[model samples]
Target: MHSLGFEPNEITYGSVLSACTAFQVPIFGKQVYSLAMKNGFFSNGYVRAGMIDLFSKNCSFEDALRVFHDVFCENVVCWNAIISGAVKNGENRVALDLFHEMCCGSFLPNSYTFSSILGACAALEELDVGKGVQGWVIKCGAGDVFVETAIVDLYAKCGLMGEAVEEFLQMPIRNVVSWTTVISGFVQTDDSTCALKFFKDMRELGVEINNYTVTSVVTACAKLAMIEEAIQVHSWILKAGFYSDAAVGAALINMYSKIGEFDLSMLVFKDVGSLKNPVVWVAMISASAQNQNPGEALEIFRKMLQESLRLDKFCISSLLSVIGCLNLGRQIHCYTLKTGLVSDVSVGSALLTTYSKSGSLEESHKVFEQILERDNVSWASMIAGFAEHGCADQAIKLFGEMLLEEIVPDQMTLTATLTACSALRSLQKGKEIHGYALRIGVGKDVVVGGALVTMYSKCGTLELAKSVFDMLPQKDQVARSSLISGYAQNGYIEKALMLFFDMLMADLAIDSFTVSSVLGAIALLNRSDIGTQMHALIAKMGLDSDISVGSSLVTMYSKCGSIEECRKAFDQIEKPDLIGWTAMIVSYAQHGKGTEALRLYDLMRKEGIKPDSVTFVGVLSACSHNGLVEEAYIHLNSMAKDHGIEPGYRHYACMIDLLGRSGRLKEAESFINDIPIKPDALVWGTLLAACKVHGDIELGKLAAKKVMELEPCDAGAYVSFSNICADVGQWEEVLKIRSLMKGTGVKKEPGWSFV
Candidate 1:
C-alpha cells in the first residue's frame, strides 16, 4: 500500500500500533510511532493510546509515560492505556500513582480505567486502596465481573478471605476467568475446603470449568491430601477432556503422590500424552521422591536423561534430595555441571543438601561456595547441612554471616540455626535465635516452633519448651511430641500424659513419632495399664509394624517389667533397624538374658545393621552383666576398629563394671585411667562399688578418693571406703574416714532396697 502511494491516515497508524502491541514488536511500534509523527497524526487520541499500550506491553514504561504526557487531549483511553501499561511492566506502585494523578484530571475513569486501577491495587495487595477503588467502582457502576474479580483477588491476596468470598458472592455475573481467579485465591489462602466448595458450586450452576479451574481444584485436593476429592477432580478432568492438560496432569500426579496413591500417580503420569513436558516430568519425579521411592525417582530421572529431555532446576532438586546413595548424588552433580546448571541457586542448594545427607559435608560446602546468587534456600541448605553433620559451630557461624549480609532468614534457616544451638546446648544462643524468630514473624511457624520446642527441651528447660508450645497457633505433631518428650524426660509424667490425651482429644493425627513419644511417657509413668492400652491403639492404627513405634514399645514394656511383652513387640518388627535391634538388646540385658542380648547383637551385625553408640552401649552392658571380662574388652576395641564408633563414657563405665564384678580390680582401675574422655561420676561410682564387692582395701580407698573429688563429699563414697577399711581391720582408717565425713557435713542416709 505504501508503494502504491496511498497516504496513511490516523486510523491506519492506530491499527499498525495496536498490531505492534499485540505482536510485542516494540522496535516496529517505534517505527510506526515515527511514521505517525512524520504525518502529523501523532496527537490523534486513538493513535496515542495505541502507542502507550504498545510501549507498555513491551515493558517500555518510560516510552509509554512519554506518550501519555504528550497526548494533546488526554481522555480515559489514554489514561487507562498508560495505567495498564505501567501494570504490565510490573510498575504497580507507579500505576497506582498514575491513577491518583488521573483522578485529579477532568476526565472521569471508565470501566477499563477502573479495572486497570483495581489490578494495580491487587498487584500491590493494597487492601485499603483496593477498597477505596472498589467503592469508586461501585459508585460509578463500573463494578462489572472483571472489576469484581480483581476485588476478590485483592482481598484474597491480602489474606482477607471472608471479604474475598463475600465479594465473589455479590458479583452480579461471573465468567470462567472470574471463577478460576476466586478458586485460585481460596487455594492461595490454604482454604482448600472453600476452594473445593466453590468448584462444586460452579459445576452445579452449569458453569464451564476449564483447564485452569481444574488445575486449581486439583491443587486444593493435593493440599488437603483428600484422595476421594482428588479422584473426583480427576474424574471431572477426564469428563472435561482435559486429562492431557499439562497443569492438570501435573497437579493430579502431585495430589495422588501426596495422598500416598502411587498407582494413581503413575496412571496420571502415563496419561500425560506429552512426556516431553518438563513440568509433568518434574511432578512425577517429585511425587516419587515424596512417596519414598528414591530408586524409582532416579529411574525417572535416568529415563528423562535417556530421552534427552531438558531437566529444570526443580526436577534436578527433587532427584537430588531422595538420591541418598552418595555415588548417585555425585553422578547427578556431575551431570548438572555438564548441563551448566551447577551455578543455578536451586540446584546448587539441593546438591549441597544431597552431599550432606550422603555424609560428605566437604563436598556440600564446596557446592555452597560455588553458588553466586545464594537465596534463602541456599543459605538454609548450608546451615542445615552443617547442623546435621554435627558441625554446630560452623552452622552457627554461617547463620551469623547470613544475617550480617542482611538476608532475611526464612523458616528453614531459623530451624537449622536452632538445631545448631540445640546441638551445642547453648541456651543463651538459642534464646537469641528465639528473639530473632519473633522479630521476623516466624516465631509461630510450625517448623520453627517445633525446632524451638526441641531446642529448649534438649537444653533441659521444659518450662520454656512448654511456653513455646503454648504460643504456637497450631500445634504440629512435632511440636506436641517434643513438648511431651520433654515433660516425660524431666519426670513430669502426669503432665506428659495429660498433654498426650489432649492431643488425642484435639484429633491431631498421630504419627509414628507421636506414638513413640507417648509410649515413652507411659513407660516413664510406670502405667502398665496405659502401656497396654497404647499397644492396642498402635495395633488399631496399624502402626504396630512401624520400626520406631515398635522400638519404643519394646523400651516401654521393658521398663515396666513386662519382658515377655517386650519380646513380643520385638518379634513383631519384620525388619528392625538399629534402634529396634538396640532396644531389644538392652531389654534382654536388663532382664539378665545376656546371652540372648549378645546373640541379637551378633545377628544385627550379620544383617548388615551398623551398630551406633547406643547399640554399643547395649552390647557392652550385656558383657558387663554376665562378667565376660575379656569379651567386654574385645567388643570395646571392635567398637572403634570395626564400626568406627569410639567408646563413650557409658561404654567405659560398662567396661569398669565388667572387670570389677569379675574381681579384676587392678584392670578396672587401669581401664578407667586409659579412658580417652574425662571419666564422670558414674565411672568412679562403678569402681567404688566394685572395690567394696571384691575386698580390695587399698584400691577401694583410691576409688573413694576419686569419687569424692568428682562428687564433692558423696556420702556413699565415704561409707564404701569406711566399710572397706573396717573389713581390713583398719579401725583407725575407718574412724578417720567417718570423722572426715562428719567434718564435711556429708551425712550418710540409711540404705534402703526395693527388693
Candidate 2:
C-alpha cells in the first residue's frame, strides 16, 4: 500500500498486520506500526487495534497492553480485538487479567469479551476459569447464540464434550457455522463416527456445509478408510462448488489415495490442477506408491522436479519404491546428487534405498557417508546391504558403530540385523540384541517380532523362540510361518505340526513359506503320511511351481525315507538346485542305500548341478557305508580340485573314517598328516578306534594320547587307550588309563537315538 504512494489506510494497515501475524513476522509488523504513526494514525482506533492485534497475536502481551494504554479511549471492539488475539496466541493468563480489568473500569463486557475469555480458558485447559466465564456470561446477560457457540467450542476442546453439547442445546439461534464447529471439534477428538452423524443431521436440516465442512468430513473418511462415504462427500463438495478450493482438493487427494482409489484421486487432481499445491502433489504421489504404481509416482515426481517444487519427506519416500525400475531410479539419484538434495535427511534415506535395490551396496555406502543428517532408516538400509551381500560380520560391526554414534535403532534395524545373526549362528551376540530390543520396546513390534523368533530358533533357542511367539500382541501368517520354521529348525516336529494345523484352522492365508516350514518338520519326523499331506497342499495352493517351496518339499520327501516321492518332487521342480540333489544323496546315505546315493551323486554332476561341501559329505558318506574306500578317496581329492570347494572338516572326517574302517591305518594316518589343515580330535579318534579293532596296540595308544591332549576329558579317547592296553595284555597300562578317567570324573555317555 505504501508503494502505491498514498499513505497506508486503516484497512491496508489491518490487512498488513494480519499478514504479519500469519507469517510469524513480528519485525514487519513493527515497521508497519512506525509508518502508521508517522502518518498521524496512532490515535486512530482502527490503526491502534491493528497494532494491538499484531503484538498480541505473537504472545507479545506487554506490547499489546502498551498499545491499549496509549489509546485515548479504548472502545469495546478494540478491547475485544486484543483479548481475542491474546487468547489465540497462547497468552491465557493475560487475557483473563484484562477481562477482570475491563469489568473493574466499569466498561460493560460484550458477548465477544465473554467468548474471548472462555477461549483463553480452553487454551490453558482451565475448566475452573471456563466455568467462571460462564457464570459471568449469565450475570452479564450475554448468553446469545454467538457466545453460546464459543463456549461450546471451548468445552469440546477441553474434553468436556457433554457440556459442549448441553451448551449447543441451550442456544436459541444456532447457525450452520456453529454446527460445523461442533462437528470439527468431534473430528479433532477422534470421534469420527459421531462427527459424521452430526454432519448428516446438519444436512438433513438443509444447512449447507461450506469448504471446511467437506474438508473435515473427507479427512475423517481418510482415517476410517471409508471409500463409499468419502465419494459421497466428494460429490457433495462438487455440488457445493468447493471442488477447486485448495484445502478441499488436498483432502480429497489424501482420502482417495488412502481408500485405494488412486484413479479417482488422479481425476480429481487433474480437475483441480490449477489449485493443486505441494501437499496435494505429495498425497497423490504417496497414493500411487501405496497402490503399487511406483513408476507412475516417479513420473509425477519428475514433473514436480521440473516445476521446481521443493520435495518433502513424503515426496522422496514415495519415489523410492520405483527403484525396481532401475533406469529411472538412477536418474533420480543423479538428480538428487546434482541438486545437493543428498544432504536432506529424507532424500538421502531414499537414495540409500535406491542403491540397495540396485544391488550396489558400495554406491549406497558412498551416498550414506555423504548424508549430513541420518536417521535409523538410513543406518538400517546400510546394515541390510551388508546382510544381503553375505557380510554378516560387517553387518554386526556396522550395527555396533550405529550404537557408538548414539543413534537409537527402531524395529526395522532389528529385523535386518537378525538375518546377519542367523547367518553367523552368533547366538551370544544375537541374544544381546534381543535384550536391547526388549528394553527399547521392539519386542512387540510386528516386523521385528517374526525375525526375532526365527533368529532364536536358528540358534537352537527353542524356548526363547516360543516365548517371543507367545508374547506377540498380534500374529499374522508371516509370524506363524516364522515360528513354525523355528520349531522345525530346532527338531520340534510335533510342536511345528500343531502350530501349522492351528494356523490352517484359523483361516489365515498360507503362503509358500508356511507350506515349506510344515514340509521340513514332516521331513525331520520321517513321517511319510504327513509329508504326503503337505505335498497335496502344495498342489492345492498351486505353489508347486515356486522353486523355494518345491526344493523344500523335495528335501522333505527324501528325509522321510520315500525315495520315490523324493524323486517325484525333485522332477516336478522346473529347475532342481544343488540343495535338492544334496538332500536326496544324503537321505540315501543315511538309509545305507549307498549304490543309489552314488548313482544320484553322479547324475547330479552329469546334470550340471554345482556340488557344495554338503553334497561332498553325502557322496563321501555313501562310499563309507558301502566300504568303497578307493571311491571315497578319489571323490575327496576331486572335491577341491574340480569343484574348488576346500575340503571342509566333515569331508576330511568321512575320508579318514572310510580308510580306517577298511584297516588302512597307515594310509589314514598319512592322509591325516598330509591334509592342508590340521585334523580335529574326531580324526585322531577315528584312527584310535580302528587301531583297537585290529589289535594294533602301539598305534591305538599313540592316537589316544594325541586325542587326550586335544580334549583331555574325552571318554572315547580313554576307552580307546584302555581297550588297546587290554588287547595287548598290558594290565598295568589299562589300570593307569582307568585311573586317569576316575581322577577327572569323566563318564562316557550312553548312546541314544537323536531326533
Candidate 3:
C-alpha cells in the first residue's frame, strides 16, 4: 500500500507483520514495525501482537518478550505469541514462567496459551506440570482439537502412555494432526504395537491420515520387522500416494533393509528416482552395509559423492564401516577433516574402527591418540580393534587404562575384551571380566555371553563354555555356533552333531559358520553318511555357493574318500577364490591325483587368482607325490622369484621329499644345505628317509645326526636310522640306535585306522 502511495492503515500493517512472521523474515518485520511506529499505528494491540508473533517465530524470544512488555496491553493474543515463541526457541522453562505470570495477572489463559504451555511441558518432560496444564485446559473450557492434541502429545512424550490414551479417547473431535500426534508419540516411545493399534482405530473411525501419520505407521512396522504388516502398509502408501514423499520413501527403504529385503529397498529407492535426497541415499548405503555387500555400499557412496551431495556424520560413519578399501577410508578421512567432522566423536570412533579393521594397526593407534576427547564408543573402538588383530596384551592393557579413567564400558567393550581373552587363553583374566560383567548387570548381553562362551571354549574349559551357553537367556546364532565350534574343536564330535541336529529341529536359520562347524565334525568322524546328508542340506539351503561352506564341503567329502562329491562341491563355486582353489587342489593332491592338482593350479592362475602360500604347498605336494623332481623344483623356485612368496619349511620339505624319493640323495642333501632358514626336523627327516631309500649310509648317518641334534625326540628320525642300519646288517649301529632310543625315552605313536 505504501509503494502505491496509499496510506497504510493498522489492518495493512497487521497483515504485513503476520506475513513476515509466517515467512520467518524478522528483518523485514523489524523494518515494517519501524514504519508502523512512524505512522503512529504500532500502538494498536493487533499490530503489537503480530510483532510479538514475528519475533517469536524468528527465534528472537527476547524481542518477542520486549514487544509483550513494551505494549503493556492486557491483550491475551500478545501473551500467547510470547509464550509459544519461548517454547519454540527451546526456552521451555521460561515459557512456563511467562504462562504462570499471565495466569496470575489480569489476562485469562486461552486455547493457544494452553497449547503453548503444554508443548513447553512436553519439551521439559515435566509430567506433573503438564498434568496441571491439562487440568487448566479442562477448567478454562479451551480444549480445542489443537490444544487437546498438544495434551496427548505431552503425555506420550513424558512416557505416560496411559494418560496419553485417556486424553486421546476423550477428544470431542479428531483431525489429522490429532491422530498423527498420538501415533507419532507412541512410535517415539517405542510402543509400536500401541501405535499400530491406534492407527487402526483412527482408520476405522473414518479419520484421515496425512503423510506424517502414514510415515509413523511405516516406522512402527519397521520397528516390529513384520514383513507382512510392512507390505500392507506399503500398499496403503501407494494407494494414498505417500510413496512419493521423501521421508516416507526413506522409511520404506530402511524398513525393508532391516527385514533383510534388500531387493525391495532398492526397488523403493529406484522408484523414487530423481526425487532421491540425502535421506534416501543414506538409507540405501546403510542397507548395503547391513546386508554384507560392502562393495555395493562403496559404489553407492562413490556415486553420492560424484553427485556433489553433502555428507553428514551418520553418512560418513556408515561408509567408514564395511569399507574394505583402505584408500577409500583415507579419502573419507580427508573429507571429514575438510568438513571439520573429525572433531565429532562418532566420526572419530568410526575412523578408529576403519583403520583397525583394515589391518593398519599403527594407523589405528594414531587415530585413537588424535581424538581430543574420547567417549565410550571411541574407547570401545580402540579396544575392539586391538582385540580383533590378535594383540590381546595390548587390548587388555588398554581396557585397564579405560577402567582407570572411570569410563564405563558398555556391552561392546566387554565383548571385545572377552574375545581378546579367548585368543590369549587367559582363563583367569576371562573369569575376572565375567565377574565384572555380572556385577555391572551386562552378563546377560547376548554378544557378551557369546564372547564368554567362546573364551571358555578356547581356554580348554568346554564344560564351563557349555554352562555359560546353557545359562544364556536367549541363545542366538552366535551362541549356538560358539558352543558347536567348541565341541567340534575339542574332539567332541558326537556332542557337536547332537547340538547341530537340535538346532535344525528348532528351525534356526543355519548360517555359513554353523554349517562349517558341523562339516568339520563330520570330517573328523570321517562319516560319509552324515557328510553326504550335510551336502544335500547345503544344496537345499542354497549355501553351496557360499565360499566358507563350499570349502568345508570340499574338505569333508575328500576326507570321507568321496572324491567325486568333492569335485562336485568344488565345481559348484561359480568363481572360486584363493581359498576354494587351494582346498580343491589339496583334495586332489591328498587323493594321489597329482596330475589333476597341477591342472587345477594352472586353471586358478588363468582365472587371475594369485596363488598364496597354501596354494603353492598343494601343488608342490602333488609334484612330490608323482616323483616329478624337476617340476617340483621349478615351482618352488618360482614361488619366491615370481610370486615373492619366500619358501617356508613346508615348501623345502616337499622339495627334499621329492628328490629323495626319486633316489637323488645328493641333490636332496644339497637342497637342505641351500635352504635359507635353518632346516627343521621335518626337513631333515625327509632327507634321512631318502638316504635310507637310496642306500646312502654315510649321508643317511649325517642326516640322522642332524635330525637328532635338531629334535632328539623325533621318533620317525630314530626309526628311519634303525631301519637303515638293519638293512645294511650293521648290528653294532642297530644296538647303538636302540640304546639311544631307550635313553631318549622316545616312543612311536600308536596308529589308529578310521574305518
Candidate 4:
C-alpha cells in the first residue's frame, strides 16, 4: 500500500503490526512502529496493543513499556498486551507488578489477563498469588477454558495436584489442553499411576491427545517401569501420527531404556528417521549408556557427528557417559571446548565425571575448575571423584568450600561428602554434615541415610550407625547392605548375620554386596557351615559367577578352613578380574599352599591381568610362608621394574619374614635398613617376632628397640622383647623390660581364638 502511494491509517498499521508479532519479525516491526508513530496512530488502542505485543514477544520489553506509556488513556487490551508481553520476555515479576498496577487503575482483568497473570504465578510457583488470582478470576467472571487451564497449571506447578485435579473435574467443558495439563501435572508430581489413569480416562472420553500428552504418558510409563503400558502408548502414538514428533520419540526411547528394552529404543530411533532432531539422538545415546551398552552409545554418537548434528549440552553429557577411556574422554572434552559447550554446567560436570571415572583426577579437577557456573552437580561430581580415588581430604575441603560459597548441597553432594568422610574416618566432620543434612531436611533421604550409616560404620561408631539405620523410614538395599557391612567391619558379626537372615525372610532383593558382607561376617566367624549355605544361596540366586561374590566366597572359605571349596568357587568365575585373582592367591597363601598360590599367580599373568599392590602382597605372603627367599627377591624386584608398583610396608614385612625363616638374619636386618621408605612399626614388629622364633638374642634386642622406637606404647613389642630375653637367659634385661612396661603403663593384649 505504501509503494502504491496509499496512506496507511491506524487500522492498516494495527493489522501490519499484528502480522509482525505473529511472524516474530521484530526488525520489520520496528519500521512499522516508526510508520505508526509518524501517522499519530499511537493513540489508537488497537495499534498500541499490537506494538506492545510485537516488542514484548521479540524480547524488546523496554520498547513495549515505552509504547504502553506513550498512550494517554490506559485500556484493558493494552494492559493485557503489556502483561502478557512481560511474561513472554521471562519478566514474570514485572508481569505481576504490571497486573497489580492495572488492577489498582480503571481496567479490570479479563480472561486473557487472568491467563497471562496465572502463567506468571505458575512460573514463579507462587501458590498464594495464584489462589488470589483464581478468586479474582471467579469474581470478575473471567473464568473460561483458557483461564481455567492456566489455573490448573498454576496449581500443578505449585505442587498442589489435588487442587488441580479438583478444578479440572469442575470444568464443565475441558479441551485437550486441560486434559494434558492435568495428566502432565500428575507425571510432574511423580504420581505416574494417576497420570496413567487420567490418560485412560481421557481416551475413554474420546479426548484427542497431542504430542505433549503422548510425551507425558510415555514419561509416566517409564517412571512406573510398566513396559506393557509403554508399548500401548507407543502404539497409540503411531496411530495418532505423532510418532515423528521429536519429544514423543525421545520420551518413548527413554521409556524403553528405563524398562530394559534397548532394542525397542533402537527401533524407535530408526523409525523416527529424523536425525536432525537432537532430542531423539540424545535420548538414544542416553538409553544405550543407561542400559550398559556404552559401545553402542559411542557408535551412535559417532553417527551423530557424521550427520553434522549440532551437539547440545545434553548430547555432550550423554556422549560423555559412554566414554570408557581417558583418550575418548579427552576427545569429547576437546570437542566440548571447541564448541564452547564446556562452559555449560551439565557438559562440564559430565566431563568431570568421565575423566574421574577414567582415572584422571587431574583432568577432572581441571575441568571442574574451568566450569564458569558450577552447580551442585559439578561440585558433587568432583567430590565423588576425589572420594573414589581416595583423595578424601581434598573432597572434604571442596565440600567445605561449597558450603562457604552458599551453594546448597544436593543429595549427591551430601552423599559424596559422606563417602569422603568415611574414607578419611573424619567422624567430627561426618557428624557436622549429618546435622546439616537434618537442618536442610534431607537427613531421612535414603541415599544420604545409607551414606551416613557407612560413614559412622567406617568411623568405628557402630551404635551411631545402627541408630541411623533404625531411623531410616524405609530401608532399601543400600541401607541394609551398609548396616550389614558396618556390623561385620566393627566385629558385630552376629548382628550382621541376623540382618541378612531378616532380609532373606522378608524376601528383599539380595545383591552381590549384601552377600559379600554376609560372607565377610561368616569368614570372621570361621563358620564354614554358614559359608557353605551362603554358597548354595549364591548358586541358587545365580550370583556364584559374580566376581565380587566369588571373591567374597574365596575369602570366606579360606578363613573357614575350606580351601578346596575356595578353589572351586574361584574356578566358577567366568572371567576373573584382578580382585578375583588376588583373592584366590591370598586364599592359597593363607592355607600355606604357597606353591599353588605361585602357580595361580603365574596363570593370572598369563591371562594378561596386571597385578596391583594387593596382588603383590598376596604373592609376597605366599613366598614368606613357603620360605622361598630367592623367589621373594625376584618378585620384589619385579614389583618396581615390571608392574611399576612400589613395594609397600606389607611387602617389606613379608620379605623380612621370608629371610628370617631361612635363618638369613643378617640379610633380613640389611633388607629392613635398605628399604627405600622408613619401615613402620609393623615391619619392625615382624622382625622382632622372627627373632623370638629363632632365639637370636642380639638381633632380637635390636629389633625390639626399633619396634619400641617406632611404637613406644605397643605392649606386643614389650612382651616379645621380654620373651626373647627370657629365652636367652638374660634375666637382668628381662627385668628391665618388665619395669619399662610398668613405667609406660603398657599391658599385653590377651590372645583369643575364633574357634
Candidate 5:
C-alpha cells in the first residue's frame, strides 16, 4: 500500500505506527516519527495522537507522553492516548495523575478516556474515584457500547457486584464481554450459582458466546465443582475452535484441576503443547499440587524448562506448591542450584519450603540465610519452614528476630510461630506472640486467626480461644473448622455445635474440613444422634470420597459404639490411604474386634501401604485390649525390626498392656524397660489398669510408682493402685494411696460420662 505512493496522510501513518508498536518495533516507529516530524505532520493532532498510541502500545508510556508534550495542537484524543497508555502499562497512579491534568487543561475526557481512568481507579482500589469517573461518563452523555463494558469490568474487579449488575441492566446495549465480566465477578465471590444463572440468561438472550465468554463461565463452574457445566463449557470451547487460544486453554486447565480432574488438566496442558504464559504454567502446577499429584507438576516444570522461557518468580512459586513430595522437592532444590534460580526470593522461599518439608531444616536454614535482605514474607516463610520441620525453638527465635528488626509480622508469621509454641506447649510464650499479633492486626489472617484459636485451646486457654474466634468478622471453612476443633478439644461440645450451626446460618459450605471438625465434637460427646446427623450430612454432600472426612466418620461412629457403621464406611472406601486404613483398624480395635483389626493391618501391609506410627498405635491397642499377648509382641517386633518404626510410647504402652492383661506381669515390666526410649504416663497407666484387672498388687504398685514420677499427681494412677490394693484386701495401702495423692497437692478432676 505504501508502494502505491498515494500520498499517505495522518490515519495511514497512525495505522502503520500502531502496527510497529504492536510488534514492539520501537526503532522503526521512531524512524517514522522522525519522518513525520520533517514533513511538519507532527503538528497535526491526529499524527501526535498516533505517536502516543504507538509508544503506549509498545509499553513505553514515557515515550507516549513525550509525543503528547511536543504536539502543538493538543486535543482530547492525544490526552486519551497518553492516559490509556499508562493504564495499558499498569502505571495506574500515573494514569490517574495524567487524567487529572487533562481535566484541568480544558480538554473534557471522552467515553474512552473515562473508561481508562476508571480502570486506573479500580487498580488503585479507589472505588470512590471510579464512581466519580462513572458519573462524569454519564453526564457527558457518552455511556455507549465500549463505555458500558469498561464500567462493568471496573466494578467487577472492585468486588462491587451489585453496582456492576445495576450498570449492566441500565445499559441500553449489553454485549457478551459485559456479561462475562459480571459472571467473573460472581465467580470471584464464590457465587457460582449466580454466575451460572447469568450465563444461562446470556445464552437465552441470544448472546454469541466467544472464547472469553466460555472461559469466564468455566471459572464459575470450577469454583462450584459443577462438573456437568464445566464439561459443557469445555465442549463449547471445542465447537468455537478456541482450543488454541492461550486464555481458553488456561481456563480449561484451571477448571479441570479444580474439579479433581487432573487427567483432563494434563490433557489440556499437553494439547496446549508449549505454554508460553507463566500464568498457564502456574495454573497447571497449582492444579497438580492441589490434587496431590506433584509428580505431574514436576514433569511439567521440566517440559517448561525446555521451552524458550526463563523461570520467573511465578515459576518458583509454582514449584513451592509441590514441596509435599520430598524427593521431588530435593530435586527441585538441586535444579535451582544448577539453574541459578536460587538467587530469586520466590524460588529461594520455595526451596526453603521444600527443604523444610523434607526434614532438611539445616539445608532450609542455609538457603534462608543466603538472602541478604528479607521481607516480612521471607521472615514468615522461614518461621513457617522451621515450625513445620519441628524446629520449634528456631521458629520462635526467628519470630523474635523479625520483631527486633521491626518487621511487623503478618498473620502467617504469627501463625507459624504460634504453631511452634503449641508444639512446645509454651502457653506463656504463645500468649506473648498473640499479644504482638493483636497489636499488628493479625486476626485478619484466616490461618493465623484460626491458629490463634487452636493454640490457645491446645494450651488450655479456652476463654482466650473464644475471644479470638469471636472477633473474626468473617470465618471461612478453615477458620470455622479450627474454632470448632478447638472447642471440641477443650470439651466444649455444645459450643462446637453452636458454632457449626452458626456457620450454616452464615451460609458457609460444610466441606470435609467442616465435617471433620464436627466429628471431633461428636467424638467428645459420643452421642449417637449427633454422630448419625453428621453421617447423614456427609452422605448428602457425597464427602465420603474425602479421606479426612471418611476417617472422621469412621472415628465418630467407632467412638459412638456403632462398629457396624464404621465397618461399612471403611469397606466402601476404594483405595484407603494409610490414614483411612488406620482409622478403620482403630475403629475395630476400639470395638474389641482385635482379630479383625489385625486382619486389616495385614491387608494394609499386603497392599504395600506401610503403616505409620498411628497405624501401629491402633494395631498394638487391638492386641492390648483383647489380650493378644503373642500377636502384640510379634507386631511390636515387626514394627521395630522389620518396619524400622522404633516403637513410640504408645506402642510400648500397647505391648505392656497386652502382657500384663494376659498375666505376664514380669514380661510387661521387661517390655517397658526394653523400649528404645522412655515412656510417658499413659504407658504406666495402661500397665497399672492391666495390673488392677489381674489382681497383681505388686505390679500395680510398681506401675503406679512410675506414673507418679512421670505425672507427679496422677489421680487415675492413685485410683488404680487403691483398687488393686482393695482387691487384695490391703486397706492400709489404699489409704496410703489416697493420703499420698492429697500430700502431692493434686486435685483430681471428676469424671463425667458424655452421652
Candidate 6:
C-alpha cells in the first residue's frame, strides 16, 4: 500500500505493528515505530498500544515503558503488555510492582491483566498474592477461561494441588490448556498417580490431548515405573499420531528404560520419526547407559555424529555418561571445546565426572577450572573426584572455597564433602558440615543423613553418629551398616550384634558390607557358634559367594580358632581378589598352619595375583612360625626386587623373631642395624623376646636398652628385660631392674585373654 502511494493512517500503522509483535520481528517493529512517529499518529491510543505490545513482546521492556510514559493517556492494554513482558523476561517482582501501580491508577484490570499478574505470582510461587488476585478476579467478574486457567496454574506451580484441583472442578468450562496445566503440575510435584488419573479423566471427557499432555503422562509413568500404564499410554500416543513428536518419543524411551525394558525402548527409538531430534537421541543414549548397555549407547552416539545433528548440553552430558576410557572422554572433551559447549555447566560437570571416574583427576580439576560459571554440580563433581582419588585435604579445601563463594551446597555436595572429612578423620570439619546441612533444612534427607553417620563413625564419634542415625526419618542400609561397623570398630561388639539381629527381624535387605561388619563383630567376640549361624544365613541369602563376605568369614573363623572352617570359606570363593587371598593367608599364618599358607601364596602367585605389602606381612609371619629360614631370606630379598614393596616394620619384626628363634642372635642384631628406616620399639622388643629364648644376656641388654630409649613408658620392655635376666640366673640384675622400675613409677599392666 505504501508503494502504491496510499498515505498510512493510525489504523494502518496499528495493524502492521500488531503483526510484527505476533511474529516477534523486533527490527521491523522498530521501523514501524519510526513510520508511526513521522506520520504524527503517536497520539492515537490504538497505535500507542500496538507499539507497546511490539516492544514488550520482543523483550525491549525499557522501550515499551518509554512509549507508555510518552503518551499522555494510558489504557489497560498497555499495562497488561508491560506486566506480561516483565514476567516473560524473568523480572517477576517488577511485574508485580507494575500491576500494583496500574491498580492504584484509573485503569480497571481486564481478564488479560489478571492473567498476566497470576502468571507473575506463579513464577514467584507467591501463593498469598495469587489468592488476592483470585479475589480481585471474582470482584471484577473477569474470571474468563484464560483467567481461571491461570489461577489453576498459580495454585499448581506453588504445590497447592488440592486448591488447584478444587479450582479446576469449579471452572464451568475448561480447555486443553487447563487439563495439561493440572496434569503437568501433578507430575512436577511427584504425584504421578494423580497425574495419571487426571489424564484418564481428560481422555474420558474427549478433550483433545496435545504433545505436552502426552509427554507429562509418559513422565508420570516413568516415575511410577508402571509398565502396564506406560504401555497403555504408548498405545494412546500411537493412535493420536503423537509418536512423531520428539518430546513424547523421548519421554516414552525414558519410561521404558525406567521399567527395565530396554528392548522396548529400542523398538520405540526405531519407530520415532525424530531421528533428527537431539532430545530423542539423548534419551536413547541415557537409557542405554543406565540399562548397562554402554557399548550400544556409544554406537548410537557414533550414528548421531554421522548424521551431523546438532548436539545440545543434554546430548553431550548423556554421551559422557557412556564413556568408559580417558581417551574417548578426551575426544568428546575436544569436541565440546570446538563447539563452545564446554561453557555449559551441565557439559562441564559431565566431563569432570567422566575424567574422575576414568582415574584422571588432574584432567577433572582442569575441566572444573575451565568452567566459565561453576554451578553446584561442577563443584560437587570436583569435590567427589578429590575424595575418590584419596586427596581428602584438597577436597576439604575446595569445599571451603565453595562455601566462601556462597555456593549453597546441594545434597550431593554435602555428601561428597562429608566423605572427604571421613577419609581425613577431621571430626571438626564434619561437624561444621552437619551444621550447614541442618541450617539448609536438608539434615533429614536420607542421603545426607547417611553421609553424616558415616563421617561421625569414621572419626570415632560414635555418640554423634548414633544421634544422626536416630534422627533419620528412614534408616537406610547405609546408615544402619555404618553404625554397626562403628560399634564393632570401637569394641562394642554386643551392640553391633544386636543391630544385625534387629535388621534381620525387620526383614530389611542387607548388603555385603552389613554382613561383613556383623562378621567382624562376631570375630571380635571369638564366638564360633554365632559365626556358624551367620555362615548358614549367608548361604541362604546367596551372599556366601561375595568376595567381601567370604573374606570376613575367613577372618571370623580364624579368630575363633576354626582353621578348617576358614579354609572351607576360602575355597567357596570362585575367584578371590587381593583382599580375599590376603585374608586367607593371614588366617592360616595366625593358626600356625604355615605350610598350608606358603602353598596358598605360591598358588596365588601362579594365578597372577600380585602380593602387596600386607600380603608379605602374612607370608613373612608364616615363614617365622615354621622356622623356614632360607625361605624367609629369599622372600625378604624378593620383596624389594620382585614385588617393589619396601619391607615395613612388621616385615622386619618377623625377620628378627625368625632369626632369634633359630638361635641366630648375631644375624638378628645385624638385621635390625641394617634396616633402611629407623626401627620402632616393636622391632627391638621382638629381638628382646628372641634373646630371652636363646639366653643371650649381653645382646638382650642391648635390645632392651634400645627398646627403652624408643619407648620410655613401655612396661613390656622392662618386664622382658627382667625376664631375660632371671632366665640367665642373674639375680643381682633382676633386683636392679625392679628397683629402676619403681624409681620410674612404671607398673606392669595386667594381661587378659579373649576367652
TM-score of every prediction relative to native: 0.76, 0.54, 0.70, 0.76, 0.71, 0.73
Q: What lDDT does each candidate get?
A: 0.87, 0.81, 0.87, 0.90, 0.81, 0.90
User: How well is each residue in 131-185 modelled by candidate 6, as lDDT tens digits?
Assistant: 9999999998999999999999999999999999999999999999999999989
- Per-residue lDDT of candidate 4, residues 605-652 (tens digit): 999999999999999999988988898899999999998998999999
Model 2, runs deviating above 4 Å: 1-367, 388-390, 403-408, 421-442, 459-464, 588-611, 619-645, 658-664, 688-698, 717-740, 751-755
TM-score of 4: 0.76
Clashes of each: 0, 0, 0, 0, 0, 0
Q: Which digits, one per residue and each the tens of the lDDT, describe model 2 over residues 1-755? A: 45678766788887888888789798989998888888887887777887788787765767888988886545776788878877876667788888888777868888988888987887777888788888888988988877888888888888777778888878888887679878877877878788889989998988867877778788888864577778787788888788878778878887887777778889987887555366667666767767878777777777787778775555566566544666766777777777677777678788777777777778778888898767788889888888887888888999999999998898888888988998888899888998899898887887888888888888888888888888899887777898899888788889899999998888889998888888888878888887787888889888886777877887887777677777677778777678777877887887788899999998988998889899999999899889998888789889878888888778888887788778888988898889999888888888888888888887887789889989987898998789788877999998898888999897878889866
Order of quality (lDDT): 6, 4, 3, 1, 2, 5
Error of 6 at 295 (Å): 3.1
Deviation (Å) of 553 in candidate 3: 1.7
Determine the backbone clash count of candidate 1.
0
List CA RMSD, all candidates: 6.5, 10.8, 9.7, 6.3, 7.7, 6.8
